[model samples]
Target: MPIIKLSVSERRRLQVFITCLLLAMAAWVLTTLSGAYHFTIKQVINFKNAPQRRAFKALQSDSVEVTMLGTGWQMLFSKVNTYNTPITVDLHTLEHSNYIALNTQIAQLNKTTDAKHRIVAFTPDTLYFDFTNRVVKKVKVEPVLDIKYQQQYEESGKIQVKPSYITINGPGNVIQNIKTWKTDTLRLTNVNDVVSTTLPLQPAKEGNISIYPKSVQLRIPVEEFTEKTLRIPVKLINNPHYYNVKVIPQYVSITFTVPLSRYTEVDEDFFEATADFSLWEQGYSVLPVNITRIPAYCRIVKTAPRNVDFLVRK
Candidate 1:
């Protein structure tokens, strides 16, 4: 191993030679990538222009492997980006035949694609579908809600959906099992007033099912509640013997919460307090007073004198 030092001119020549080699390698790569080539990529399939008179279900998956003819640069980019735009296939051809040949649709499918990257072929080559009788039916819409109301606030009345029912069209076998459709979740927090908004229906799980009017109007009545107390008479129940039974405390004070708008409309007549005499035979000394009925929108706070002494006379 002897140390050898090169002259200044020799070192300069070596540097120039190395630079030229690197430049040639770079030029070769660029030229190769610029040339046209065929490549394969997976693309999602979207069906359009469906036949009007028939319902169809695809026999295969929603995606297909597509062979594309494009420049090497496009192939390089396609490798780096895994997402390929979906190819739309017209189903109007199904009116005559149950199968669609992808090769026949190359021109139509390329309309939305870049001219530089044309569709050469599809892996499946053809698409098949199963047909069934088309049917239309009206189904109720159920709203999904997640709401938090402020203290002393609540819904005053039933929630109203502008179009309570929606029309769905699909294969009779599929539509027969679907009784109702649901809307997307409507979320609200710290709500103290009326809620009115439009919500879109949840998308159909089956691609063949179509819903009319994608959205619906929703109205929820809300109001502030206030406490109200009323003295309601306790009536005896289950006295088949027709014996005279008198409760020691004839009237019980019932306290409940009612919306402000309906405060004046509610009274003792809207409540029914009863004491079951059948408990006497069950070894109870007193009868338990229960609020048997109350308005739908009202919430009971407390019923005074939960138990009452009763007198039985023959």
Candidate 2:
């Protein structure tokens, strides 16, 4: 590296130029700090000491315009950060009307600002608030599901909800009409197995409400089902004492599809097939075999020999 050394006369001239620039900068700074400047800032209002089982809703906006007189340096810093510290309005200090005139409270804000700056004026000098009685209630959670299963797979049992319910707190007028909270729509395709997940609850479109425990878990049971067939005997029912009728067919085949869990529980004895003689008519000689009972879980796929001929002996 090559260094270029300056002569004494040249260095003295450079030093004088630097000194004059520093002096001018200091003079400008002092002059700017001496004058007062006006600025508009946003001061958020916080509600504290609210009554139990009560919510405070300010009828107006939560922010206020606070015009203050301050030096240019103070205004510059404040403008850089227009968000001032929040001021508290204690509900315990309000009147029966549930209103607080903030005109008296501005003095408290001035104290929190920079000591060199003066808060000359502000708008909304006063604000109105509505204190509503908070009502808490538990409502059922509804799942919105759109699911498609793959071949040979289907839902086995009812969809189970973990929480089942949610607690909501809001104004009485709004909470009174809330019957249930529904979750957002869930879409799934080719679901071959169980779907266990947590879904977030959607806010009610109509009211201003707050829900606790925002999300709930859903356990969707799934299984594969195979076709099952059973043979059931046809018996005579509601027969008159004078007439004894015997069905031409002694047994009928009942084919159904049962879930694997209930495969052993469903059988011939689990169902009832009977031909009611009372239902017999003169021209209608065909005895209709009525399926009086079947397992609740199994779906009946088919029944053979729906009707049979009967020989009556009196």
Candidate 3:
């Protein structure tokens, strides 16, 4: 192959082009390395689950300062990009944990990457995070329990569950000196047969403690189906003294569906079934007879609403 050669003028032109390109590249490098622009170094603190997070009672330092090295473009975009969000380490989690310099964790935040992809680095070679023991406020723990009542019995009966307290896990200062959690009064009224329910646990008024399990299991003892009948005493209200009127029916049949535990509370003699004659004077042709004063745990299965009709002639 024949050798190729360049003329003098062509060579000179090529030299000038190379010189201009190198000078332009040098200027760009100097612009970045001048370090005239001010940059911010923000300490990053990361925390998960912001919604359910517990607030810190105290921290050694709220803010930290670091020297940043980067171009103007990198500094502006750094604000939008998160280096880290504040973290609240439960003091309890730190129990039996020592020789751990908190500053090491803070240093991780300083090396945070910039959003603008600038070749920037942080100064001081490390970050400082000062965390002090905080005074935390106490939160109440609410427990929920499920219960099933005995058969053939209404739910109006009272129940007792031993050791109704629960343990709460949280910051050390919060759970360290805590004990006992209570449940609210369970209200099951006039419910016959086996019943199942979840009871909410209530916490004592004191230090802040959050219960791990919001609900608890409640199993109520139930008795099999049983039938009982009693003769209830009848009482009358607003009897007319002017007219000789008698309560045609003196006794009413009282039946109840109750658990064996509550059977003793029922008193048939206490119940009074009566039709007020004054209602007739008030232009009432017929009075709707109803049973009053039934056992709290008992239900009226068969009630004699119109057991008897009285004939009164004045």
| Candidate number of the best TM-score | 1
Per residue, candidate 3 scores C-alpha lDDT tens digits across 97-199 of 3222434444444345443332234333332322234333333433343444344543454553433455564455655565555567666644445444566
Worst 10 contiguous positions by lDDT, candidate 1: 79-88
lDDT of 2 by residue, 1-314 (tens): 53968889989999999999999999999998778888888877776665555655668887787787888877777766754777666565543556777666667757776677877765887777676778989999999999998876777787888799999987787788889889988899998888999989886543235688889999998877778988899989877675867788889998887778778877788999998777675567888888889765566778898998889876
Off by over 4 Å in 3: 1-156, 161-221, 240-243, 260-267, 311-314
TM-score of each: 0.87, 0.51, 0.39
lDDT of 1: 0.91
Candidate 2: residue 250 Cα off by (Å): 6.7
What 10-residue stretch in candidate 2 is worst by lDDT? 203-212
Candidate 1, residue 269: the lDDT equals 88
Best by lDDT: 1
**Of 2 and 3, which scores higher on TM-score?**
2
Q: Report the Cα lDDT for residue 257, model 3.
A: 68
How does each model score on lDDT? Answer: 0.91, 0.79, 0.51
Per-candidate alpha-carbon RMSD to the true structure: 3.0, 9.8, 13.2
Mark the regions of model 2 whose C-alpha exceeds 4 Å error after superposition.
Answer: 1-52, 55-132, 233-252, 272-297, 305-314
Candidate 1 C-alpha lDDT tens digits along 120-205: 99999999999999899999999999999999999988999979999999899999999989999999999999999999999987
